[model samples]
Target: MPYPDKFNDSYSETKADAEKLVMRANGREGLLTCCIRPSSIFGPGDKLMVPSLVAAARAGKSKYIIGDGNNYYDFTYVENVAYGHVCAEKTLSSEDGAKIAAGKTYFITNMEPIKFWEFMSLILEGLGYERPSVKIPVSVMMPVAHVVEWTYQKFAKYGMKVPQLTPSRIRLLSCNRTFSCSRAKEQLGYEPLVSLKDGVKRTVESYSHLQAQNHRSISKASIFLGNGNLAKTVLWEDAKQTVTVLLLLAVIYYHLFTCGYTFITAMAKLLSLTALFLFIHGMLPSNLYSPLLSLFICCIYLLSND
Candidate 1:
């Protein structure tokens, strides 16, 4: 339970408590329970870490490092977790090893501790993202992270997903935490199948679609005015496109509300245009018609307004 000297706010208190529950159940008759604490689990099909990191990278928020980049973190590959569990099970079931493995706790990891920021750089660079270089003091980051977490907690009842940069996450990033898997290695015969480099490679390849090079970063104003990358590019990437969209919106607004058209007449005219569109759509060949479908759909939306 000793915390690192540099950081007072140690991460994973909840998980630490859960680990204790297994330890408490350890000596119960006919029961075999042991806790496996895996650090920073990352791999393919990882919905939590991978997606959140990628989202931050895509948002250009991954360009800043909290505090010095020297903190060591134990990162475990997902497959290694599976392997560790299997080894634990075998050790628990085998009469020869049961005494050594049962009623115990083990730290599961790749046994390769890297500087936390360096690990982030590896994942980001592998996924064609910019490695975070700008250093921000933890004192500065903590307040911002606190505000973000508070805001999220306040609005979470309205169905908001918790953001990645919480106070605990900041502490984890800015502090050192390297767990020993020596006991697991000696007792359960658990060895990491995936090296850190190999695991990172697999993770990056799994998320090819989220590569940073494929996207264009934007400013906060652009994001607020527009919605996101997809929305910005589709609407206002080109000046002509922006103008066209605005003009169309204005036209629709004018016809529906500004002009002296009755609701019934507008509805009737909208239906007539819709019928004409369907007629043209039907006449066009499949290959030729497919690409223009979105434009026609937009036109339908425009007509429906008036």
Candidate 2:
């Protein structure tokens, strides 16, 4: 494969540089070295990929497909990657095999080029989450990702945490990344022991704590919000209530703290305004009438529509 003149990210750039360095030192000082490039290494002990997927799922972000969802990817199991390394080392042990394998790079995969979104769906479904059904085009997501990446680049040093969405990641999610493992198989005798299907099943089963059923624990705030069918509809539990409270707190903070007035004075003024408003509104027909019945119906409507 032809190397690009410019890489999308530093991670890819560094990997390519490291491979070049390793290949350069292949025959020097009687040292044998070869680079084994594994495609999307994932399995039971995976920390980054699986955890990130679960986090996205919980955050309600995993319902989106970044592209048409037909891009092919070669995902190698973690054990298969390790086995590839072993194969490279064993190949280097023999003179004939060393000539063919050393000073070279070999792509390692499960040899199962599955549709990228299909693989993601399998994992998400296995973990008891809804499969991503909404297709979003790459062109639509790329500009947003670029803006986010640019923001992160500027604010990253100012206590801003790294963002997950970026242009490179968008490309990764939408582009085909399958690589042929013919070189590895022919030169180093490398073949995946675990199939991709079994690897995904094992990976999903390993992260049992991230399952949807295990994640839906009722919080204290939900209990305080009445915890009935009507309450659930109106408050919508943590996602909605938490956001509402945060916005409310921001307003309160600006008024009470950022303003010139003292905290006690601001509190008194706020309470006074609240009491006056409630007193006036309490005399209204809407409040005097069956408010519960009206509120219940409104909540039901919002719940159904939402």
Q: Give the winner by lDDT.
A: 2
Global Cα RMSD, each model: 9.7, 12.6
What lDDT does candidate 2 reach at residue 281?
A: 36
Worst 10 residues of 2 by lDDT: 238-247
Segments in model 1 whose C-alpha atoms lie over 4 Å from true places: 1-14, 27-29, 152-163, 213-306
Q: Report residue 76 deviation for candidate 2 (angstroms).
A: 0.3
**Candidate 2 lDDT by residue in tens digits, 266-289:** 888767755543343334444343
Q: Per-prediction count of colliding residue pairs?
A: 0, 0
Question: What's the true lDDT of residue 158 in model 2?
Answer: 53
lDDT of model 2 at position 282 = 36
CA lDDT, every prediction? 0.77, 0.80
List residue ranges in candidate 2 displaced over 4 A: 217-306
Give per-residue lDDT, candidate 1, residue 279: 51
